[model samples]
Target chain A: MRRWLARVGALTAAAVLIAATAPIIMADDLTVTRGAGDGGVAREREIRDIKSEIHRLEQRVDQLENENGQLKKSNAELKQNADKLQTSTTQQLSEIQSRASAPPSPADFMDAMNRFLGRYRFTLVGGAAGSYIYDRKSNTNTFALDLEPIILWQLSDKLLFEGTIEANLPAGSSADYQLPVADFQYFLNDYAELVMGIFDQPFGDWYEDQSPFWVNRFITAPLPYNVGSLIPPTEVGLQLRGGFQWGEMGQVADYTIWSGNGPGYTNATCGSNTPPSPLPDCSTTTALVGDTLVSDNNIRLNTHSPGFGGRFRVYPLPADSNFGRLELGASTFDGKWLDGFWLTSWGVDFNYFRDNLQARGEWIQTYRQMPQGLGADNRQGWYVQAGYFLTGLQVPLLPSELDQYIDRLEPLIRYSGINQRATVLGNVITTPGIGFTGSPALYAPHAREVAVGLDYWFAPSIVWQNELDLELPRAGGFYSDTGQAVGAYPNDRAFVSQFAVGF
Target chain B: MSRLIKFGMMAALAAIALVPLAPRHARAAEMTPAQQKRQMFRRGAQLWPIYCNTCHNARPGGEFSPTEWNMIIMHMRTQANLPPQDANAILEYLKASR
Candidate 1:
């Protein structure tokens, strides 16, 4: 019985201990299982989070790569642009240098000038002459130099102003200056023009066309158009002039009409003191030759009346005809002289040029009504001139060097005459280029002259001219009451040599 | 009649006669540039001697440049009473020849 009790108590104690230990073990096991489950869930959540993060990081890296590619493309475009700009700048610099180095062409220079000033030009045209004269009757020799300057100004397309200044210098004499022409012209159309101020009178062709030192064939003018002739060489006037094609055959016609101060008259009477019984009323007679003395006004010297004149010219042949030009002209001038006396003049002229030959002629007639019933003083004058250039002659046998010189030679001839009808006051005239000395052939009522000339042309408008003139008096002799022989003047001869240039 | 009145009448008659001979602007405008230039040159050659020879010898065309010819023609137009058409044609010829 005692052994069984001991064994049982031991067994109980052991069982109690076992039970406590078992409970502790069971609790520890449950805690371990729960911890294991929780740990597995936490690990799964972390793995999912990590996978999402990796996806986001990959997207960010792709974005960085795209940005890098864009940067590279922009940089390439910038470089191309810079290269183009540099090339363009270099080309421009070279062009500028070349332009700066080259000289401007004529057209370019003209363009530059045109920009500075409107179309304008300045030029000088003139003639110069040196002459030596030998007079037979007076046994005198004279040397003279003349200069003429012609200026033309074009104000516009239709307006023009022209002037001529003539300067004459004779050896041992004071210089004389004359304004031959100064005029303003306005074109009415292609065919008509109006001229104002002093101009060459449109009378015969001599004064208006052929009086220039370089143009005239001889040093001296013809007898009819000399300084003491019936009409003045120039006049202050208003003129209407023009030319036009007349027909389909190419004929041309020109006309000129002018109004100016008329001629004057002078009469000589015993001046305050009467001469001795044999002086024949008056010692000298006064005559009115030309009315150019009073250029400023028409009232001086009884030249109040206005003169009317006109000229008409016609060219029958075609302008391009091989025969050259043939021109025929008619002119007339009529005016009132001093004391209401009539002074009328008419002229006809012809010019023909063919090859190297030129021929021209003029006839002029004037009638001056005298005061005190002295009757009309009728005057007639005529001149014919011809010139032939040696170039027209074909001389094959001449040496080549001599041909050039021979071609420059021209021979000219002119015959001029003047007839003055008797005046009741004893017809007496004062000659030009000579003092009031009594010269028979020059001062005679009727006179004739023959002039021959030889010209050597250095250029188109420069020439050396040699001329000889013969002056012959016509009609019967006349003697003043003082027994001075006026018409008994013997024939006279003159020689003149001139060097002229027109530039 | 008074002398002035007579002269005026004469001038009037002359102007009347010249009206029909005026240049035809319409005809000139209708031509081509080349044709107009050629015609002008021809007309200038034809009229050169007729006008220039009346006073002095005709100068050579090569003596002046185009600009110089223009000035010379303007001067001669007034001095010689040349019609505008003739003057212009002469200028063209001178320039062309040079």
Candidate 2:
């Protein structure tokens, strides 16, 4: 060990800083056009404080660099002293060596802290993806790509600050764009937390886990996850949540709750029923209306009500050998964007993994409420999917002949459904429907699709995903433009093939 | 203060390395669902090393909510291009820690 220590070299200042503060202390990569409240003064002061802290941290890093070299030597010395102080372990041995006894020493104490220790880390993510699509109905084949990267700084054991930017070229259709999601988090006693900055809108499970491309079997989360993408999943605001576990039906259970921005997407739907654009900009009326904000989308587009919701996911299949992994969950919200809208939802996800096969199924129900005459559209929707893996896999090169030629391969098939009311798409009149009070031009995009997919994972990081899109027959009408003559489903069939790595 | 600084540096490194290893520890133990939910603090603290340990401090029950933590994971997923499942795992880990 001493020989290994002697061969080491001095580490860089950047490396030391990266080590001392958990690398995340300085990796924010987002900048925006918005200014802080009370003008730029607050921002200026904050900048000043950060600069001072950076200096202090750097100095501390330099000192730690010196101490790291001593840790090994110190440990060795302590171990030696402990050895010198001890002669034998058992009573029989101690009796034979009476003079070998030594007083309790702090030698062991120093080493104990070394074991109960933590670590620091910093990560940088930058990626690019090009989408090439050929749609027979639209008679179009298009290719586009997007690039963005993120950096995060873990300041302490319980503090985190992160920054992100989205850069796409040529806007929405062109695949050219840029957006930033930056925030600071303070874990207030573990279960309780406080966060302020741009964040994802939390309507369901899909939106929160929309990336890596490895977790899912498709292009993205369901459209309803963010109200048809009309609303930015990330909003600026503060959120609070905390929950714990208990016993239920002979299994483990979990629950969580949150509050932030709730009424942003309502304005888009409320516009059709209101005079023009009527945002739910009544932050003060949350108690009156009983709405809370879980994610802030901004005042310009928000209905101004806070968003609040709770969730519970439990495992209750009685621990079957190879047939059961089931979880049931429910989340509900009451928010006012244009007029005031409500959503109550519940879902179930089931998984059964046995031997060389896996199966999964899920269903969700969302009940919505609007004003009697203005925002008068009420609706619910859901879907289900199941799949299985055929191949029994093992490493090919580790002295096993059966693994080399095959690598890895599996085929899958699936079908799903959805139903929605036309009012959700920004249709419907004020007196006849629950309308949009913030923006009149707003409308909703509603439809359903059933897709069959084939995916193959050759290596752990290498995969081939291919899917055929089949439209489901389902729709509702609110007005003439949105009421175009059509069948139960209008989405044409399309195929998607994707190759990705690093999750 | 100096000792605290030393602790900060070494602790930061150990925490950083914990990010990847976090998934391994991401499992929130077999506490009752109620304890798991209330273990927000304990779980949050536990999560400090696995999920946030890479770039943030190991403040465990220190900052953020299970939901807020979920949102952050979402942002990082889209912004940093993290895969959906990994994002979910991180979310689950962060949530449990909270």
Best by TM-score: 1
In the order shown, the candidates' DockQ scores are 0.36, 0.03
Q: What DockQ was computed for model 2?
A: 0.03
Maximum-lDDT candidate: 1
What fraction of the native interface does candidate 2 get right in terms of contacts? 0.00
lDDT of 2 by residue, A182-220 (tens): 777655542244556666544344444334344355543
State each model's TM-score restricted to chain B: 0.77, 0.40
Q: Judged by DockQ cut-offs, is candidate 2 incorrect, acceptable, medium or high?
A: incorrect
Error of 1 at A59 (Å): 28
TM-score of chain A for each candidate? 0.72, 0.56
Kindly report which residue stretches of model 2 are placed more than 4 angstroms away from their true locations once superposed.
Answer: A1-120, A125-128, A169-175, A178-180, A190-193, A226-232, A242-251, A266-300, A317-324, A339-375, A393-407, A423-446, A458-462, A473-482, A486-491, B1-98
Model 1 interface DockQ: 0.36
Which tens-of-lDDT digit does each residue in A474-498 have in candidate 1?
6322232333334444677778888
